[model samples]
Target: MSTFQRFRESWLRPILFFGNNLLSLIGGALTSASAFVLIGFYLVDAFGHGGSRNPYLGIILGFFLPALFLLGLLLIPLGILARHAALRRAGKIPSVYPRINLADPLFRHGIEVVLLATFVNFVLLGTATYRGVAYMDTKDFCGATCHVMAPEGTAYPVFAHSGVPCVGCHVGSGVGGYIHAKVNGTRQLIDVLRNRYPAPILTNDLLPSASQTCLNCHRADAWIGDKIRISTTFDDDEKNTRTRSLILLHVGGRDLTGKLSGIHGAHLGHIVYISTDTRHQIIHYVAKTEADGSVVEYTDTNLKQARVGVQRAMDCTDCHNRVAHSFDTPEKAVDRSMLAGAISPELPFIHKESIALLKASYGSPEQARTQIAASLKRFYQSNYPDLWQKDQPRIAEAASRLAVLWSQNVFPFMKVTWGTYPNNLGHNDYPGCSRCHDGSHNSASGQSISSDCSVCHNVLTIDDSNRSQLADLGVQ
Candidate 1:
């Protein structure tokens, strides 16, 4: 007989003896079942024309099933060891395992079955593992699949960076990153199962650095000159008096002439700061690195002594923190709707009414929706009966729009209310640009960080009804 034949014949009897036990038999059955289920899921995902977009289904196929498959794999070896131990304890093990008769049809059939099963197990394991990891990296898995992420999930589709995947920001781009994400995900899963996760999840420290994620698409050296911004708002009066503001934003960056010019150019890689709070709104120190490698440090004069906080280099996310999941303030949300004609500005006190309803507290979104719509209708019915009857359709439209706006901005279940997350792009509603540019931070030689209005933006018009300048500039 050949060497392979001799080895197989010598080992086959013991393999059969050990694997015939109940534990090993059960392990084999479990392994076979899990493998088949995984194969079925893969086939459906591959051929079902977009498959099932259901998030829960993905959890099963992506995470739970794969875990089951791995457990089954582990049990196979454990069962073999248990069987070996049991036989030795019983003193049933012979001095040498019996040699098999290769010529016997039963032994030959058993060997053929084992070889085929092993080959199938290897193939399925590889395919299942690859698909499971790929599924976990999907946007749905990160957002819709997790209850704690509902607030972000609701806000993501409305923002500028909706096209990008969550992993683009949360996970790094290599084998190491993949491993880290999976390990973190496992811990998160455990927390979720135990109902121990924090509401309104904070991810400031959890995110990968901007260099690994954001810089992949937006280069810091790219040039972008000044840009104009026009904003409109309505007063709380009966007429809902409209006013507009025109501002020129100095969104400077590196220019084609190879000179760093604007806001992005000034801060992208040249600044470091200390934030004394989790939100990074309370900046206590600022340092600018000069072109000549000289560093000038500025300490916040308001702070009695230099307090320790998170010290880090400034990056895109420092300013554009809400680019992907931005929740608008009540005023901004109402203004956008009225501007879009979803909420009629023709209705008296509509802006004021909308703001009042948006700011009110409620136990849940459904309750908020019902209460807001009923409250608006009641206000019109009680105060302006004639107008209520005449413009009922407009009132209904406004109520529906406000209810949606409220739901979009507030998540009572997650404890995410108005301004739960601060946008650091500007200083209007939050301490954004003013955190470092308030002229309070002074260098040792008495140089202060400039708070001058003209440094960042120039306000051409403030709360004016006139659009003549915007018209003249062809931006109206």
Candidate 2:
């Protein structure tokens, strides 16, 4: 007889006897199906370049299929056990269990098949695990899947560091960091499933140090001496008079003479501070380590208690917190749009109308878009019929641009309206530099943190002539 026939009659028949019950048979089918599906997914992912392009498809193949495969694996053994117990209770237990004889070729062939199957399973499991982790690391997996992160996710794509992976800043490098990030992600997933996630979710407190993430791209001592910034504003008048402000920003770093200079250099030394609030907007104390290792402590005189909050070392993100996900104020947005000629300055009271339209409340984004455009058209058509007749298209275009600004910055669903998250870069809008530099923080020796106007920037002219200094510099 053939070795296969011998095996089927002897070893295989005995082994199959236990799994002949309905539950075991069902489990066998499920296991077979799941294994085949998993293998198919792996093959397609391996050869299909980047696998499924859709985020939902990636979630299914990466997470759901593997879970089903595991479920099937567990059910197989459980079904076999239950069947054996039922047979035993009915007094149908076998007189002898299946015997193994290594001397027989049938036993040897069956052993070989089991070993090969095990190896294949290991390969599949390893690949699936690797691919699953890789998929989770992607930006789409992080931002697109989570509803609570909508505000940041929407702003991220249009920002400066859009190309950088979310994990690149959020997670530390190496295996430990990867495992930590996964554990945190799993906790977040649980929160999302339970609908317990907070609206306008706060920034994570346990972020990796800026040295490990930010310094990889930005140099600490790189010099960028002085930068001239021109800001234009239109007055709320019949003529919509334009005025420009030219400021020379001291954005310097370390010079060739090894002297630290400018804004960057002043902040490059070892420094620490205490923030009373979660968002770090209220600075209570500041301490700077001098060159000789002397620490100068500067406590806010306005604060009653000196050490009442979270103490943290100073870093690049302390000021540039919203670099990757900045939401502009309505005034800033209008200024940029007008400067780009997206909203015509020639249109009467376009600045005032745009700001009012943007700041007004609406139930939804669609409503905001519709009402903003309609309101602008109505105002122009009623107040300035002559201008409206000549600049109908201009009014429509300006309204559309305003609508876009509102959509980009405001999300009613997430309760993320204007100024929900403050940018700490400037002192005008938020308590940015003034948090510590408002002439309030003083040392024991009566010296206070300088809040001089010229410390960071020198204003060349405020509300100067209509002619731009940029045009004079041949940079129109």
Candidate 3:
């Protein structure tokens, strides 16, 4: 026989033998095909003109393809082992191990196939691992996959740190963090599938250590200085009188002199508190570790219950809980729409009417949208028939804006509405700063958590009818 003929028989004979078994043949074919296809797609997506900008590319390359590749790879081994066990039981082979002869044609072919398969398996394994990890790190995997996270997914894009990844804050650094997140994610997935997740998803358990997450971007010691804030509001009056508040916020940071001052500094390294509730809204005990390393404990006079074992150190999130995924109240939402000219301020009682309509309960988002538009239109027609008839376009535009605002802030399916999640940034809307600094928590020495308004910000002007303050500041 020619050397070529001998090599062909040696190399190709055993591969054909393996293909005789339907299960093994199918599994092997699937495994090899999936690996090659995934590698090709990934290469194209990574280097192509569209790049990663296409959302579906990530879903395919990171999630679906990798999953199929892993599944096929696993099935290949199982099918081969099953086929071996069956042959042994049926007396086709004396034992599970086939006779090995280096010079034999079958043995040579088997060895070649094994080497090639091993290399293929190794490459596929690496690809699967890479894609799996990348998929889990995506925002879509976290927010879009689960219906419960729909509200967060919708709000995330408009948040201050919209560009920041969800995992950046939720998942910590290191192997332990990755494992923990995966395990938690699995549990959440199961909960979602089983329809067992809580309404208005509570994040207390999932909240990562702020020191590890928040501090990655914001340095507690960095000098922030004072921030100028101007709040504009309009009354329910005919003129839709614009009122403005000019305030200088004392956002001082750790100075060169080693003094911690202002909003961030006040609690960054000095404050710790214990809350009696799950939401951490009711703070009863507080301990301030002064710069001298002395600790002063404070207790709420009205809190008759004993302290819980849990004590949380004050962090950026404690105050800025809604920094991301913030839900605005009807009043604030209307004010913003009016300020942006989305909702016509020229309409009589537009602000008041919008607020009233938004506050009224509805069954679903669709119903809310329809009702909001109908309600607003009805108000204008009933109250000011002539105006509503003359300015139909303006009324329709205002109604459309109000409907969008309602949809953004409220999710009836999730049982999330305006004010559902308390924003701990300020005291006006929620008992945010007042939770600890309500002038109620008193130390043993009779010292209270400072409720002084000027400690954090100076009231330059508040609800000024005249635009004089704004004019002087060149803001109007």
Candidate 4:
């Protein structure tokens, strides 16, 4: 017989001894594959950095790669059992098909081929796993995924630590957080694929108890001292004059006993800033006596929530809600940019044109540029033909500024527009202070929160500049 036949009769013929044990060997190999994949994924997820930044990726790969390996492992035993049964009727022992032994010249190369292929597969899979983990860790994944959240990625650099991931605050610290965000993200993916996502894209559910997530680092008692409030303002496009306001809010905090106090002057060391889940708008608040031994919850009926039971505790996210995402209303952006001299102020009704141009509908950035250029040319030709004729260079500059504004603010390529994540810090954005103070809702302390502008910030002017000269622009 050939050398292969001799080897089969010797070492390979021992298959009869392991005829019933075939399943065990195959099962063990599959187990090894699964163990490798799971152990690999765990290292990648728990200790790796990539997946931490891109939450969506962690949602996809953190759970999927391990699952695939597990499924493959599970099938191995079933395959072995089926093969053994199939061969028993033929009086042949179950064994590794087309068995190759190193002593046999022709089949010896097959063993090396198997080893080499397995090695490459492992190396590549390991690299992919590491990359996936690192991608999940990136801030880009947190703020930019779902595409609608570009506003968040665009703004995170403006706030405090630029490198902090979204999960550091939103999901906080817990293994449960890791699982919850990923599972919810899967459902969100299905929705996005089916085009069934609700407007505003509500997906986060089973939010971890705020106690574990929010207060772990930001203990209420840790904050102390009065805070200086900085404010900015905008004016209507007509006259292009300033309509500024300022605030010196009494943001008092932790006192001698290390308890945060003076929250809206309630004398409660513990304050619960409550709001509607509608838009994360502050609706009403609850406060317990830091030492009074009474606990109560304050709700705002005026809050635009349809169903209740969505109350959350006050934390960094409660007030500093827009830390990662901020979109300036077009009027505000143009007004500030013009004031900053990035866009020439006298660029032929540029402020008005810029705001209008930004608000215009377009399919994409390229389309927006084309439409805005045509619209602006027509505007100057109709409204200020003489001025446009005189200051053509300034007009060009204004068009360029407006084009940049549209590109950054309106990314139609991703189906992203403006105002995706609205902040409820101020009364105008969502509900904010008005949720409680607007001549509606019940107060827990029987004390009133004011709707008057002066209550929080001094409004120097009103519908007209003459309002500033009026007699009754008084203090709160």
Candidate 5:
């Protein structure tokens, strides 16, 4: 009976139903996936803004999403059509089925089938095109596609809000800004692909919108009081000399409107600070702006620019740059390893040995670590046998800690070794606090970061050139 009944329906009929329904299901899924992807992206954009001035990722995403939705919208109709065809073959003719004939003697039936599938094909093609364009526009894809960004990109995870996308901060508000960023981003991609990219490139560019972009959040009306910066160092000797330097805080805030300028203006709600390279490339600018139209810019350049206009812009990141994800500073790197008891501070030349091992260098980090250990062992065994035995354990720990510190701070790939990525928040590398504090810059105002540390901050003691002299003041 089964065989007799099956004889009435050709194998081709079932194949037709299966093919039709499968295509229909896939088409519907494609449409739904597009919606889901868009929603998911919107959610990610909303919560992922950190260190971002434009806070409008949602806006841009919303704007671009419509185009993608159109593509999905197109896909839905094709899916509907496929489902109608399948139902008709199942003997459940859809109310609006196109009378397609598979039993035709000529090629008419095949032509109709081709036409039907073509509609679905076109929709899928559109979806693919939209996805391709969208992916290219994403900051993650833009900043992360190349191997060159690996070292720097790795830094982004710990910077600002961990979830913030790269575009949030780099690309700000408006269609004008959007267009500029697109053009710039494409050019950067080309640079990476062609290897025409410059080394030590600045992440932030000129025409920074400290005036517009930053002032939205930080206002200039909330600044007051003197700032104090104090630092201490530990010597292996019984006496851990503490050096103190205190500065009266100088910060400005915005007017009724949230507008602030420079670090001097906004301690809290005032403005942002940014920094640039010597040529004025805003390498890693940091700071916020206030509603009253004030801004604080602290550039990596630290005002070492030999020129202007061509000078770089600074961002809040320049100093408070490492706010959340702090890597090891050279001294701090030593201190961490020493404190952890990882290295042998007891080893002869423990400090000196750590320095040398760090300096010796290797092609790879693993190589560096291995060589550092060997170098220390050889140095101690060859020179100070007694100290090596006593301090070997501490020294070993120090070596490991140094290796980790080097791993975090030293980027040998970009020709950045220890002390290579110099911190210019203040002026050690390029005039730092001195740039503003120098009597020359303040000649008009009669204010300066004088040679006398006491002017800006009460210096309790001096560590460099003269370590023994204490200010006699409580800090000294």
Candidate 6:
């Protein structure tokens, strides 16, 4: 017999017989279709240029299609095995033993065909595995798949490190980090499926070590020098008088001599503290190690019990905890809008009105949007009738912008609103720098953590609208 004829009879006939069964047939069809679809998506994502990032592609290719493919692959073998058992019980074949002879043309042909099919199946499996893993690492898969992560999803894009992937910080480089993330992700997935996840999404368990994650991008020894920061605040008066505070931030880092100075240099890898609360808001004890290898421990004077709970080393995250996903306060949001020209600063009491609308409580996002716009429109029409008539479009535009700001920062479903996640970057907003350096923590030898403002930054000008300091430095 010809090689092709013998191969078809021995190999193709048996495969068709097993796979043609109802369950096996369905599984085979599904697996083939899903494999093709996933490959197509992978190709487009890999090669496409100048096209917008397609988040849904990651969902379909990384998660849904791979799951379907795996299910089908598993079903195929189970169906074939069941069919063999049923056939044996029915006495269609005397025994399940195969009549084999290596030298025979039929046997050789069957072996050849089996090897070929196996190779093809392995190739497809490899492709699917690669695509599945790659998809899971994407920002869309992490932030968009779970409704509980909506707050993070909304804030990430507007954050300073928006371009950086979620895994870059959450799951650092190396096999161990990847495995840890996957295991943790599985638990989170189970919680989501069972609806057992906590509201506001506590981040204590999700935090990765700063040395492994944050330090990967930010070098400790890199010179940061000083940063000039200008903050604008508006009064509630009719003129909405603008005032600017200019400060020279001493963000010094370690020099070649290994001398630690400034905010980051002073704290990074040197300070350890104990917090009684989960949020780390109430620090009870602090221990500082000097360059001479001497350790000085400080206890909070107010707290009767000093060593209350967990003692943790201070890291980058302690201060920059909300760096990637920070929500703005009502006042800050209004200030930003005016500065960006989204809301007219010329409008009388616009700052006060916008802040009031933002602070007001509402049941739903839709309600907030509608009410904010309505409230602003009513205020301008009733209080400043002439201004409202003259610049009706400006008022409406400002109201719409305010609504957008509210939606971006607040998520009613997740129980997140303005200031829900405290940004620990500054003292004025939250008990950030003051958590450890509030002057209340004193060592046994009488050394206290200095709460002096000059230690970290120098105030160039305080609430001066003239911006004299900026002008002198040739800055607008």
lDDT of 3 by residue, 324-418 (tens): 68889888888899999998889988887888888888887788778987887788789899998899999889888887888888888899988
In order, candidate lDDTs are 0.85, 0.81, 0.79, 0.59, 0.52, 0.81
lDDT of 1 by residue, 1-476 (tens): 99887666566666776777776777787788888887787777789753559889887877677777777777777787888898899998877666776789997897898889889988888877787778777788888988888888999998788999999988887888778887988899899989998876787877777888998898877777889888888899998988888888888888877888667777854899998878888899989999999999999999866657777888888899998999999999999899999999999999999999999998887898899989999999999999999999999999989889888888887889999999999899899989999999999999998899988889998887457786787754
What local lDDT score does residue 420 receive in model 5, on the 0 to 100 scale? 40
Best by lDDT: 1
lDDT of 5 by residue, 219-260 (tens): 434553345554544464433333333444344444345555
Q: After superposition, how far is residue 298 of candidate 3 from its true place, in Å?
A: 1.0
| Per-residue alpha-carbon lDDT of candidate 2 for residues 214-279, written as tens digits (9 for 90 to 100) | 888889889899998888777777667777788899999988888899889998889899888888
What is every candidate's alpha-carbon RMSD to the true fold?
A: 2.0, 4.5, 4.4, 7.8, 12.0, 4.3
lDDT of 6 by residue, 227-298 (tens): 999888888899889888888999988866877678878876478888887888889999988878889999
| Better-scoring candidate (TM-score), 1 or 4 | 1
Shift in Å, residue 233, candidate 4: 4.1
Against the correct fold, how does model 1 do in TM-score?
0.95
Give the alpha carbon lDDT tens digit for every residue of 273-358 in model 4.
54445565455554444466666555554555533445555544545556555666687678767877776766545766688788
Which ten-residue region of model 6 has the weakest summed lDDT? 93-102
Error of 2 at 427 (Å): 1.3
Better of 5 and 6 by TM-score: 6
TM-score of each: 0.95, 0.85, 0.86, 0.69, 0.56, 0.86
- Pairs in steric clash, model 1: 252-262, 253-262
Deviating ranges (above 4 Å) for candidate 2: 1-31, 38-51, 74-96, 99-120, 465-471
